[model samples]
Target chain A: MRTFSRNNLSFIILMLLPALLLVTIFVYYPSIATLISSFTNENLRIPSSGKFVWFLNYTQLLMKPEFWQVTGRSLLIVACTLPLEILIGFLIALLLNENFPGRGIVRALVILPWILPPVVNGFLWNWLLNGEFGALNGLMYQFGLIDKYVFWLQHPSAQIFWTVIVQTWTRFAFPMIILLAGLQSIPQELHEAAAIDGANRIQQLFKVTIPLLTPSLAVAIMVEFISAFQIFDIVWTLTAGGNVGQVINPYTKTLMVFNYQMVFRDMKIGMGSALSYLIMMMSMIVGVFILRNLYNRGVDK
Target chain B: MKTIMKKSVRYLLLYTGAFVALIWALAPIYWIIVSSISTRTELLSKPYKHWIPTHPTLQNFIDVFTTGQKYRAGGTLPTSELLISGLRNSMVISVSVAVLVTIVALLAGYVFARMKFQLKDPVFFYIMLLMPLPIWVSLVSLYFMMTRLGLTDSNLGLILILGTMALPLAVLLMATFIRDLPYEIEEAAFIDGASRWQTLWLVIFPLVLPGASSAFLVSFLNTWNAYMIPMIFSNTEKSQTITVVLSLFIGQYEVAWEQMAAATVFVMIPPILLALFFQRYLVRGLSMGAVKG
Candidate 1:
């Protein structure tokens, strides 16, 4: 048995070898190197192995108004879009949960927006919302809502508003799926019991359904919060990162977009690395808080 | 009469909600498809002439697929050659990442599920920690490493990065699948003098085929849909994926809506088909960890 156990150990090590190497090289090493590089004066254009300059990058970034604007914009996107996504997702989930004709097909179709590559969603919306020849403008005009075409993406505030709508469209399906699963798991008897106790549908929904659905909602919120906070790809494609020569769009520069410009465009590797850590730290803090809430809620139940 | 009215209203509300959901889910896609099949004249006409094109044409799609043809929108647009090459590159990278990641994930997943190693718990926890760290956090360091290794603008570089990105989830999914399998099969194989490696291939492999395919499909869709990594890592035509190529259509002077829409449709077809056909696996693979947690 001892010899067999020894042989099994070697097999285990062999099996685990590839995953360990890949994760270390790709995930762990880069993460650690990012932390170290954050302290250096690394610049891609500068050709030298950058020297350590502790907190210089952090201090400089903290002082920059552009940094705050970008960070604030990212947070604002999360604030604006998270609730819309959750509410729409919850409402859709509730509607889908009830049996109807072709419910299966409708559920399948609902995943379309979520599955489409976010870049494609951006392009699709851009086409739909184009100033000169957009379908939206045409429809609104035919309906006599507006005589002149509204250039949706041109104005800054409108740009932010549309960004939120596009994001919600692309993402709400995920929370819907999660919430649908949550709903299915709640026993039918719970609703029956509520009805027997003289609770109306709305009352049962508030008293029984909402309380039971909190965990799934929490999970969905955490995932969506992180996703929205790290918004990229869509914003990039939507605004084309704001013209060629510019560093970033003043209106829609989220953190990831800002990091892209700093690291890839400006070649300011040190500043970008610092920004990366800060973004990671913020996400981690929020993530841990939500997780603790989830854990405590679980314990209580 | 009151009860009937209430029941009728409930059904009315449900169907109305379903109708709105359907339209919300599909309108953008429908518009893209309409635009793809519409002529340049129809697309650019003020107050757009028709809800569905009066004169729909497949010319845009043909122009997208045919090589070396200059797009109708004229000067300096992405030639058909670039879009086709981009599609090819995407296919290669996605397939390679899916296969390689699944194999590695399966091996790792099996050990984590069945082995009783001293470091198992710590290693698993470490991986879980890495899962939520956004890819942007490592973008800079990874760029430097890839550049140093001469891996920038290469297929292998993308496959490696994307595979690594997909690993933790793939591992977790595979582990869950394997844990559900009874261990007696493995025990029987071992008692028959088969090696652990042999038992894995000959016994466990067949049992976990469904899980493996789910992992493969999810990874494939993820790699195919990846834009940011490919956009940064792959600079040249040789390695640029469809998403990167499609992005070039925008930000151009006098944007070619028709051609861009056609390309978008082409790029969307594979993922849309996969999602529709194997949605069960997709939903399971995507939501498994969160729901389990």
Candidate 2:
């Protein structure tokens, strides 16, 4: 043990240094810095009196209608997009899981959209959603479904609806890939045994597949929710902050957008810091809820 | 008899589904390719443009590249010189961030994975805990830090943020890969009078490079496609990202449909190609990470 320690101790420390530096500076420091700034009115571009305001920023933010509106909009989009992605992803996963020719090629094709830079996906959909000279509009007019172009982003409902569609496309590949793994992991013998006991395919799916795949589904959803909350790039690119920095879907703003406007647009750095903390607070709330529920589950078990 | 036919036909249905899925996914991309060929005059002539153009031309690509006209937020377009320099800036930021993160993550991740320490487990958990927070939560505060360091619009400023964000997951993944490697090789080197640094350099890093390479790929992808940090830091041509520049084509009065589509496809390659090449290990790593959790 002493020999091992003497031989590798510094090398071990050297390996730890990069991660430690990265975490301390970028992750831990910025988060704590945000926590500190949440209380002050400094918005300090240069060094000034870092005088404390003691939750005044938080109070002012809570009073703003725009803040509440953006929060509501984020929740509404999450509610709409999350379940549909899970359902569609599950179906796609099952379809891909079946033994067939060119299965590897098919899986590769399915993963394509997910790997697209959020910018590419957003731009891809922007053309498809265009009112004039867009492929979708041209097709719709050809089929006599409409006499003229449908202004997609102008209307609140179409923008939000289409945002859901775009978000779904960008994100669905993740859950499908994860779900495919989960489906492949299930024992084939269980299905074979169930078939002999007079169980049908649908019954076997519900009885065996769904329950067993819950953990993977949970991971996929976790990624989706966290990413969905950060759904800035697609929305920003597709809608260009959508008419005074509001979401095209549901006619609201998000914490990220709100903060962007506050700091970069309005140059109100104090309020921007406040908005950042609010977002952090909401994430903590979700994290704590998940943890408490997990604990309760453990106790119950 | 019905059961036998149904069973036989199921395989046929799977192939059909596979074909349809590929077509649906490829359709939009194909439309972009076809539209990018048309003259602006031909594109504007009729309400219903041909799926394949009549006077197929590269005029729009020229206009987008040379004319400097981009869609403004309120719909009327603006003449801006943002395209060429923006592309240069993005390339610089993405490639630099990728190289830097790979080296740092390689060193740190090797340590976390192989070396024993008192705080190692908790420190690793801390990295995971920080992963799920939407990074925008820290954007405002970090902006201040960048400003304090005089890095606000610099490529270095953006690279620092990008490299930092990529570290946590890269290290976590590195740790897992390192832990899986056998210890006997390193132990043998120790007995042969090799110094600790010598053992790490000569023995460990080479054996585990593929996993580090995977982490590098993931890190590079994150930075290459990133828009928000660049969006906030610099909108000027010198430091703007490809994603931010593409959005300039989206305006209130009009959408530069063809140009945006063309630009989007151009910027999509680095990350998508990375995934395509490294897919075998990436998919396996993703699965193992999920199961481990």
Candidate 3:
């Protein structure tokens, strides 16, 4: 029996080996390498063995005005989109939670935008919002809403606003699903008790529903905050990373886009590595809170 | 009369909200389909002619499938070959990553779910921490690593990278599903004198098929939709995915709206079908780690 138990331990180790090895090489190793590379002078454009620069990249990055601008823009995007996503998500989830004919079908169809590739969503919106021959302009003209077509992606501010809109469109379904699950798990008896106490629907929602839905809402916000901070795919396809030329559109360049230009286009590998760590640290701050929440919930369970 | 009015108001609000939801979800999809089928002349016309296409055609989709087609503005439509190859590469990568990640995650998930081990909680927690680490943090090093190993521009490279990207979630999902199962069955298998391997394969495997399928579908969709990794890693047509190829269509000197729409439609079909058919599993898999305990 001792030998058999020993064999079972080996079997368990063998089962976990492949996943462990993959995660170590792909996930953990690259992370450590990025940290190490950030301290070195690694430039792909310059043919030189990268030597330890030790704080040069970080100091340079911190001093750049563009760095602060891009970081601010990324945060602004999170601020603008998170509330809208949560609000619309909550409203839709509430609407969907009520009994109706074809509720399931509506629920399924609503997730269409979420499931479509983010790149495809970007292109789809680009076509619709095109200035010269856009469907949006056509619809507005026909409805007498506008006298002429407008170049939607022309101005930098408009570009940023549209990015927020498209981001909301692509992402709202996720929160809706999370919140819907939260709503379903809330015992119907709570609402019933509230109603018996002469509470109105709005009162019950504020008194009971909102309070119960906090955990799911927190999960949605944290996850969306991370995604919105790392906004790349939509921005890349929508505005061409602000047209990818001599002057990158300052308004539209978020952190990931800035990192891409730094690493890929500029080939400033060292600076890009530093930027990557900065982005990771910002995200990790949020991630730590999320893990704490998960840990607390796990303990309760 | 007041009761009737209140009830009517409730129904009115519900249906109105549902109508708006449908339009919100389906309008962009509908517009893309409309754009894809419209004639190039009609699509290019400045002022709108019709909300619905007056004369729809499938030429754009045909152009996507066929090679050597000429653009209306007189340049060779170079995307057909690229798009087709992209589609094939995407399929190969997504399918392979799905199978590979699913099998690996299932093994790890089972061990975490059923086995006793030292430092198990810490190990599992460490893996879960990888979940929130944005992919950009390691992309630079990954790029260098892939290039050093000569894995760039290769489907296998993407399969490996994308499989790792999908791993943490798949493992969590599989573990969640496995944990929900009754322990009595495994105990009964043990009492039958079956080896651990035999019990895992014959007893646990069949029971966890649903979880496996969920993990597979999620991984498949994620790989199919992955852009940044494939974009950086696979620059050549050899391994560029449909998403990457479609991205190349935009920001040109003269954008091809009709054909781009067609390609967008083509890329959307699989995920739409998956969402429609396996919604229960998709929702369960997606919301696994975030919402559930």
Best by lDDT: 3
Off by over 4 Å in 2: A6-9, A43-51, A240-252, A285-301, B1-4, B41-46, B54-63, B66-81, B252-256, B282-288, B291-293
Best by DockQ, which number?
3
RMSD of candidate 1 to the true fold?
Answer: 3.3
What TM-score would you give candidate 2 relative to the actual structure?
0.88
Model 1 off-target regions past 4 Å? A1-7, A46-49, A242-247, A288-301, B1-10, B67-78
Give the lowest summed-lDDT range of ten residues in model 2 chain B.
B284-293
Query: Candidate 3 residues B1-293, lDDT tens each?
Result: 99999989999999999999888888989999988999888888878645688899998899767852333221444667777889999999999999999999999888777777677777777777777887877888989898999999999999989999998889888787787789788878777788778888999999999999989999999888888888889877799899987776665433667877888899999999999999988877777656663
Query: Tens-digit lDDT track for model 2 on B122-212?
Result: 6565655556666756776777777789888788888888888876666666666766789788888877888777887899889878777
lDDT of 1 by residue, A170-219 (tens): 99999999899899999999999999999999999999999999988988
TM-score for the A chain of candidate 1: 0.91
Better of 1 and 2 by TM-score: 1
Residue B98 alpha-carbon offset, candidate 1, angstroms: 0.7
Per-candidate total of colliding backbone pairs = 0, 3, 0
Of all native A–B interface contacts, model 1 reproduces a fraction of 0.55
What's the CA RMSD for each of the models?
3.3, 4.4, 2.6
What TM-score would candidate 1 get against the native? 0.94
Whole-model lDDT for model 3 versus the true structure? 0.85
